[model samples]
Target: MGVRLNGRTAIVTGASRGLGRAIALALAAQGAAVAVAARTERVWNDKLPGTIGDTVADIEAAGGRAVAIRADLTDRDDLPRLVEQARAAFGPVTLLVNNAAFTAPGRPPRPGATRAAAGPPTTAAPRADWPPFVGTPVHAFRRHFEIAVFAAYELMQLVVPDMIDAGGGAIVNISSVASRIPGAGPYRDFSGGVLPGYGGSKAALEHLTESAAYELQRRNIAVNALSPSQAMLTPGLSYYRTDFDDVGSEEDFAEAVVRLALVDPQTVTGRTIGHRQVLDGSFDPFGP
Candidate 1:
């Protein structure tokens, strides 16, 4: 109903469930033909609800156009194919929501939790000892960068031409508060500290967002990184963190994403901001 993307196509990665699913649904509701991309095609885990098929079904049931794209973002080959599938199913991609990310290894496990109790096997690594960042594996950093930074950059490269030909577009990169680097110590004993690999990758992504936005602004493409102002208990987060009390809602977060998707590139680009910032009228997309 908003932004009037009736003829536009959108690609949303990690859309099988959680925040990504919410975002895809919001985009579809706003009239974009959405391509829901994720690894889950079937219900592999009952604990992790929803799949690309389920997302597509939900969209169709609501009378909006959508396609299920089963893609593993870690697979480089899947990137181009995912874009092509969306383009073929609808039209040139004018919108992208890079919502997929590798769940990093951290989070103090709930007491008496086993390896199986640590949510999806694929997404989460085995529970590490307290002070998890110690001796963190190189592969963990690689995986985080592969999905959160490299894949996003590649997808942006693949879609810019389509957007250029169409005159304009928008890209919203889902980031996290974890990306925030802690200041000088005297730091409190935070139980849920973010691991370096995950936080580092997101920090890199924010840089990518700004760099891309600067280059693409003249071409009428807006690129921005968005994070929740506070923790939200989505399915993924609920599995790792149960300490959040005053949390944000998925609907509000999705609406913020929709707003970013609809931005006028010339006026608003390169913002590394929060959902509450977008909603509360404090986000100056043009500001430093």
Candidate 2:
């Protein structure tokens, strides 16, 4: 009834703010004991707001169970410890929302580039899109993949075994529409901002999700990648565009993830479902 998670436990990465925070709260409200993990535990800078502690307090205040775990997603070594801590706080994680990602704005573009780069290159603006693909540093691009793909893989390895033993579980890899837009079909003119580094990373994550889903289905574990059917106007992105046209809300995403996380593993494994599709009970991602 209404996707109850009563005895389940969940780990929401990047729960410090934005989508992660919203998803964590949603899970807890649905009766899941949530573990909020993020590097930001307290306010050190005014640029970004929200923290694991804040998320936990919000969850607890609403009469739900949650714990905060401070972790840096870039550091692969910290994942096991993070998972261990979550397990200790609640139990084996039944749901893992891999939403943590790194995308720093206003960084100097590649050498020899100047005003030609995308976004405000030298603005004091609170939010700006990433530099052009050619201008992005290799290391910087690698970090996006590290957090979105590699970090997620490491965490999956840790929780998967336990998930199998406990019967079944779900893994939701939070991705972006940037991963697939302006493609080879009739929808080729769509321009929802382009940053190859972040986009490539998300594409790889979706591939990993499909492959993992195929292999893990026998174990009763489902892996799916989800992206907002439309652009999301989060606070970070809002600084650039205040208009909410054709954008989905954070609550929409959180609710979709909740439904996906609670679905039957075998029936829903290996999909790259969108927010609207999940809400509409459209399991066939390729259906017209």
The models' CA-based lDDT, in order, is: 0.83, 0.80
- Best candidate according to lDDT: 1
Task: Give a tens-digit lDDT track for model 1, residues 20-52.
Answer: 999998999989999999877665444466788
Candidate 2 per-residue lDDT, tens place, 216-252, comes to 9898888988888887866455544555568777888
Error of 1 at 138 (Å): 1.6
Measured with C-alpha atoms, the lDDT of residue 13 in candidate 2 is: 95
Backbone clashes in model 2, listed as residue pairs: none
Tell me the TM-score of each prediction against the true structure. Answer: 0.89, 0.86
Q: What's model 2's TM-score?
A: 0.86
RMSD versus native structure for model 1: 5.2
